[model samples]
Target: GASSSVFSASSLASSLLSPFSSAVGLASSGFVSAAFSFTGDSTSFFTSSATTSACSVLGPLQHADYFGLGKLLSVRELFEARVHLGHKEGLLNDLMRPYLFGSRLGYHVIDLDKTLQHLFCALNFIAHVAYRNGIILFVTRHQQTAHMVEETARESHEFAHTRWWRPGLFTNSTAQFGTVTRLPDTVILLSTLDSVFEEHLAVKECNKLLIPTVAIMDTNCDPRLITYPIPGNDDTPAAIQLYCHLFKTAILRGKERRKKDEEAAARQQQEAAGTASDASKQPTSA
Candidate 1:
C-alpha cells in the first residue's frame, strides 16, 4: 500500500536526486528493466563488478527506480530513432564534450550510454511529480517540431509553450495572466536555445522560480543550465517523438499509481467509519 503521506517536494526530493547522483548509471538502481543492460563501465566511479556491488556504497534511495521507465528504450532503439546523432563538431559546446562518444565524419556522436543514464533520471523525476499531482510544462523553440510537441503535451494532459515566451510569464505570473497563475512544478525543455547563438529566456526565468527542468540537450547546447540533461540530438523529429512517447508513458503510470492510492485510502476511511458506527450502537462500556 502507498504510504499515507502528502507527496510534497520534500517527500520526492530523494526519489528525484538519488538516481542522478549515482555516478550517471541507472543499472545500479535496482529498477526492473527487461530490454537494456548497462556495461560495467557505466559505473566508472566504482571498481569493476567483480569487486563490489553498486548497492554496497549507495543508500536505499538510490535503489528506488520504482517507475522502471528505464526499460522503455534500449540503446539500440535510441540509435534507430537517431537520438545519438549530434551537431557538427565545430558547433559542439565544451561543457557537453563529456557526453560525446566521438566525432564521426564532421558530426559529433552522442554517447548513448550516458543518454540512457540521464534519461532514466529525467523519466523518474517526472513520474514522481505526476504521482504527486504536480503540473508539468513542456517547452521548445524549434519551429519545425512545435506542432508535434504541443500535440504530445495535449495527449499527456500537460501544458506546452512553443510560441514566443512572454516576458515575466513565470517571474510575474499574476500580472501577465491577469491573476495569480499557478506555476508548473517542473518544465521539460526539448531545446534550451531559441537559435544557434541565442539562449531561451525561459531557462533563466525557470531558474529564478526554482523550477526543476529536464532537457534534451544537443552537442552545441550547454548542459549545465539544465537540471537533468539527456544529451542527444534534440532537433531530430524521430528522436523527439521517442522522447515524447517515453515521457508520456511515465506520466500516465504515475497518475495510475496515484489513483490506486487514493482509492485505497478512501476504502480505509469508509471501513473506519463503519467500525465507529458499530461501536456507537453498542452499550457504553464507561
Candidate 2:
C-alpha cells in the first residue's frame, strides 16, 4: 500500500511538471530504481521529442507571408511612427549627418525626409529582388524586439533568426548543416550593432558572400558596415514595426508585379501562337 502511494505521488509530480510526458504505469517494485528510472527515462524522452517537434515545425514556413504588398509607406506614417528618435550626439556617425535634422537635449534626431528617401530606395531594392523571386532573411539579435521581427518575417513569408545570429550561417551553410541547399539572397538586419554582444557575425558573413544587406542602424552604429543602411532607431518597437510593414509591402508588391508579368508573358505567347495559326489558315492572295 505504501509503495503504491509513493509511485502515485511521483507520477502526479512528473505529470504536473511535464504535460507532454505520457502516463507511466504503476511500478510494483518498492526499490528506488523502479520509481526513479521511469521518471528519468520519460523526462529525457519527452524533452528530446518535444524539442525535435518544435524544430521540425518551425524549420521554415511553407510560403512567404504575402498578405498583399499593400501600399507604399508614407512620410506622415514615418513621422507618426517616431522613427526619427536616436541616441546621443556623441553616438552619431558622421556619414549619417546627412540624415539628421538636429539635436534635442542630448539625442540626435533623424531627418524624416532622408529617412523616407533611404526607405524608398531600400524598399524598391527589396521589391525588385522579390519580383525576381529572390529570398530575404530578416535577422535580429535584440530579445526585446525579436518577437516583432519574427512576426514580421513570418508575415512577409521570409526567413528570420530572431533568437540568435548563428555565426557562419551563410558561409558555412552547406558545411554547417549538410542538408541546407540554399542561403538567403538578402539579409535585413533589425539591429545592425548590438550593444550587448560583439559585432553580428551574420553581417560579416553576408559581406564575404556579397549578399546585400539592409540594416536599421542606430546613431551609434557605423553606416559603412551594411550595403543599404537606413539610419533610424533600431531599438524602438514602433520604428521596427514601421520598417517591417513597409518591407513586407514592398515584397508583396514585387511578388504581385512578378505574377502579373508572368501572366502577361503567357498571354502574349498565346496570342502570338493564335495569330500564327490564323495566318496559316488564311487563303493566299494569288
Candidate 3:
C-alpha cells in the first residue's frame, strides 16, 4: 500500500531496497519462511516441501528455489514495491481476470499469492538457463526505465534490446543483422505491451522462433502471449527495480553454481590423472 507512484517520500524511498541494497546485502530466508508460513504454507510451488522437516519426509534439499531466490522477496515486500497495484478497473483485460485480488479504489490489486508462484517459476527457469550459459536478452520499450534495464543486463553480463524492435530480428536474422548473428536463448520482457493498445513485436517474434520468454505484465496485458507471465505493476520504476534485483540475483546464483560445478569436474579429472600415473609407476615392478 506504500507505492503512491514513484515513492518520492524520503522515508519510503530510503527503505525502497533495504533488503536488496547490493549483491552482498541479499535478503535472508527467514523473511521467506515467515511469509510462507503466514500464507498457510503455500511453498509447495517452490519445492516438494521446504518447511516440513518431519522424519517421514526428508523434503527436497535441492529444489528449484535452492538458490533461495524465492526467499529473497516476501509477499509483503511485493506490496512495498507497489507490485500489487494494477491499472484502473476500466482497462482490465478479460484474460487477466483470474489474477485480480479485487479492486482497491477502482484500481485492480493483483493477487500476490499467484504472483509469488509465477515469479518463482520464472526465476527458477532463468537461473537454469543461465547455469548452462544460455544467452538472455532484456527487452523494454519505455525510455523511462530503459537505462535501468540495460544496466541490469550489463551487470549480469547479458544483452539488452531497449530500442525499437526491428521486424526481422528473429524471423530473418540473416537479413536483419548477419548470417552468424546469434539469437538469445531466452528473452525477458520487462513490459510486454508496446503501448496502450498493442503488444510488443518481440513477443510474437520469440514465440515464432520457439525461444522462451519471461515477461512482467500488468492486469491490462494478456498472459497467454507470454511463456511465463509475472503479473504486477510493470510501469513503475520501483517495481522494475525490484524485478531487476530478483532476476540479477538469480543469474548470479546460476553463474556461481556453474563455476562450482566446473571446479569440481576439474578436481575430479586431476585426481583421476594422478591415480593413473601412480598405477603406471607401480605396474612396472609387478
Candidate 4:
C-alpha cells in the first residue's frame, strides 16, 4: 500500500509539469516567428531580408505600373538613372508636350511611364527586325555616347558610326557613293537629329530610302522625324548605358531565336529525308 501511494504521487507530479512544458514550447516558437518573419513577394526566404533592407536603404518604394521592362531595370532604377529628367521647360518642343510628366524647378521631367511604353515598343520592333537578319546601323555623333554605341554594335555584330555621318551614306547608289557595296536596312540614332546638324542629311536619306529609323528624342527634340521615337533623357550617361544594354540584349535574343528556328527547320528536313529513305528500303508487297 505504501509503494502504490509513492507511485501515484510521482504520476501526479508528471501531469502537473506537462502543461508548463507545452506552454514553454509554444512560447519559444512564437518568439522565433516574431524575431524572424519573412515579408515581401520574393521566393527567396533567406535573401528577402537582405533585399528588403537594401531597397529600404535607398528610400521608400514608389508605386510604378510596370509592364514588361522590369527585366531590364526596375522603375526605381530608371528613376535613379535620371531617365525622367528633361531639358528646361522652355526648351521642350510642342510635339513632346504629351510625354512630360510635369515641370520640376523650371525643368520639364519626362514621364517614365511613357518612356517605358515607348522603349518596350521600340525594343520589340528592333528584335523583330533583327530576327529577319536585317542590317542595323547605329549612328551617334554625340561624343559622350560614341563609345557605348560602338561597343553595342560590336557585341551585336552590327555596324555603328561614332564619327560624323557621311552624307548620302544611305540614299546614294553604289555608283554615287563609290566603294560601298550595300546599305543598312535600319538606322538607330543614339542622339536626336538636332545633336548633329550634319546628321540631318542621314535622316533625310533614310526617309528617301524608306529605311526605318529609331531615335531617342529628348524633350527638346522633335519626334516627327523618326519612325520610332523613344522619349527619354538621351544625354545622361546612365540613361544611354541602359538604352545600349537593352538594345544589344534585344538583338541578341532575336538572333538566338532566329538560329533556333533555322536549326529546327534543318532537323525537320533531315527527319523527312530519313523517313523517305526508310520507306524506299522496304520491300513492296505485290
Candidate 5:
C-alpha cells in the first residue's frame, strides 16, 4: 500500500532546513545566479561561495573536468547508445523497464535503499558517458533532495575547485507534475521515492508516449516504470550523497565544454568585428 503520509512543501522545507539549510540556501541561490551568468567572462560565483564555506570544510572534491574532451552528444543520443549496448549485450530488460506494474512495484518497495543505490550508480554512469561525449546534463528533484544536491555541489566545488554545479528545481505534492513539461534534452534525476512517486509515475506515463527518460530506481519503485532502472537503496543519506556527486561531476564536465564553446564563439565574433572595422577604415580609391 502506498504510504498515507502526504508529500508537502512545508515538510520538504523542514527537511532541507534541518541543519545546514542556511548554507544550502546560499549555495542554491548562488548556483542559479551563476548558471544564468555563465557567459565566457565572469568569475564563477558558485565556486567562490563553495570555497568560502562548504568545500574548505568538507575535504577534497573529485574533479570531473578531466573527462571533458570529446565529441558532443545529446541526451536522446546517449539513450539510444545505451539501448544499443544493452541490446547487443542481451541485457535490454536488465537495463530497461518496458512497463512498470503490480509485482514489479512490490519488488521495488521491499528494498528501497539498495535499489536506489543501483539506480544512482546507473544514472551516474550515464551522466559520466554523456559528459565525456560533451553533452550537457541537468538534474531535477523534489525540494529536499534538490537541496541536498545543491549542498553537495557546494561541497564539491569548494573541495575540487571546479565550477560545474547547478541547483535542481523544486517540486512538491501539489505541483509534482510541473517541471516535466519544461524538461530540456538533458537528463532528469529524481530523488526521494516516497515524495515524488506520483509525479514519477506521471512522468513515466507521459514519457512512454513521447519523451525518453533515464531514472534512478529504488527497491520501492517498479522497475518496469523506469526506462533505465538501477536497482538499489533510496533511503540512506550516503547513497544520495554518492549519486549527487556523480551527477555534479557529469554536469561540471558539460559546463567546461559549454564554456569552451562560448569562448570560441566569442573569439570568432571579435575577430570578425575587427576585420569589419578594418575594412570600414580603409580608403576606397575608385
Candidate 6:
C-alpha cells in the first residue's frame, strides 16, 4: 500500500519529462564534460572522514525507518543520477557514438546503449521507491566496478539535497539471502541476471516471498527472477557501465534525502536544547 502511493506519484512525475528531453544534453554545451568530471579530487568528493562521519551521524543503517521517511520518490533525481553516472565513466560518449555516426555499426551500437539506458531508467524508478521507504540497497560483488556507482552517488548528493535519497553500498557475501532478512531493514539486492539465471528456480524462490530486487537483466537471462528487471545487453562493457551509472544516480538521490533528514534532526535538537537552556535561565515561575 505504501509503495503503491509512491509509485503513483513517481509515475506521474516521470511522465512530465518528455521522452526526447530525457537525453543528457539539456544544459549548456560541453555540459557532458562538466557534469562527468567528478570535480577536484575524487577523494575529497567522498573522503574517508566523510564516510565515517556520515555513518556516525546517521547511526547504523539497521535502525533506519524502513517504512516511513525512507519510501519517497523523485523522478528528476533518478534521471540526474543516470546522466551523471554515465558521464562520469565516459560511457556517455560510447552511448552517443551511434547517434553521431549513422552507419549500420552505429545503429547497432546505439541499440545497446538505448536498451541499457532504458534498464537504467527502470532501476532508477525502483531506487526512488526504495529510498523513500527507507529500504536498504545491497549490491553483490561490491568490488566489481562499484566505485563508479559510489562516485556518481556522491556527486549527485553534492548537487541535490532532498528527502528521497539515502545512498548505501553492500556486498553479497554478507547478505543472507533468505526470507527477506531485514538486517538493514530495507534490502535491495543488485546483481546481474546472467549470474543468477542458472539457479533460476532458487533465485525465483528467494525473490518471490521476500526482498525487492533490482537487477540488470541482459538479453540472455529470463526476466522472471527479478522484481524490477532492466533488460539490456549483459556482455558489453558499455552496458555494465551504463547500469552502474544509473544505480549510482538512484543511490545519490537517496543519500541526498538522508542528508536533509540529518540536518533537520540536528536543527530540532539544537532548538530543543536552546529551549531547555532558556527555560533553565528564566526567572522562577513563583
Under the 3 Å rule for N, CA and C atoms, how many clashes does model 5 have? 20
lDDT, candidate 3, 8-95, per-residue tens: 2232212222212221243323222212222432332232233333311422122324456756757777888899999999999999
**Poorly placed runs, candidate 1 (over 4 Å):** 1-63, 275-286
Root-mean-square deviation per candidate: 9.3, 24.5, 10.7, 21.8, 19.8, 15.3
lDDT of candidate 6 over 1-286, digit per residue (tens): 1122122322322422222123222221111110111111120011134334544454323111211222222333333333212112223324233322122322222233233334434544444444555444444333444554444435544211112122221223234453343433223333443233342232343454444555554333455555555443334444456555555556665666656777988999999999999999989866
TM-score of each: 0.77, 0.72, 0.78, 0.72, 0.37, 0.40
Stretches of candidate 4 exceeding 4 Å from the true structure: 1-70, 173-176, 194-199
- In terms of lDDT, the best-performing candidate is 1
Q: What is the lDDT of residue 104 in candidate 1?
A: 87
lDDT score of residue 59 within candidate 6: 37
Q: Which segments of candidate 2 are over 4 A away from where they belong?
A: 1-71, 195-197
Residue 95 of model 1 has an lDDT of 96
Candidate 1's displacement at residue 138, Å, is 0.7
Give residue 27's lDDT in candidate 3 (0 to 100): 35
Give the distance in Å from residue 133's predicted Cα in candidate 5 to where it truly belongs. Answer: 17
1 versus 2: better TM-score goes to: 1
Cα deviation of 248, candidate 2, in Å:
0.3
Worst 10 residues of 1 by lDDT: 42-51
Global lDDT of each candidate: 0.76, 0.66, 0.75, 0.66, 0.37, 0.38
Model 5, 79-175: lDDT tens digits are: 2222111111222233224222213322422233223323333433344334344332334445445667556546434211112122222223225
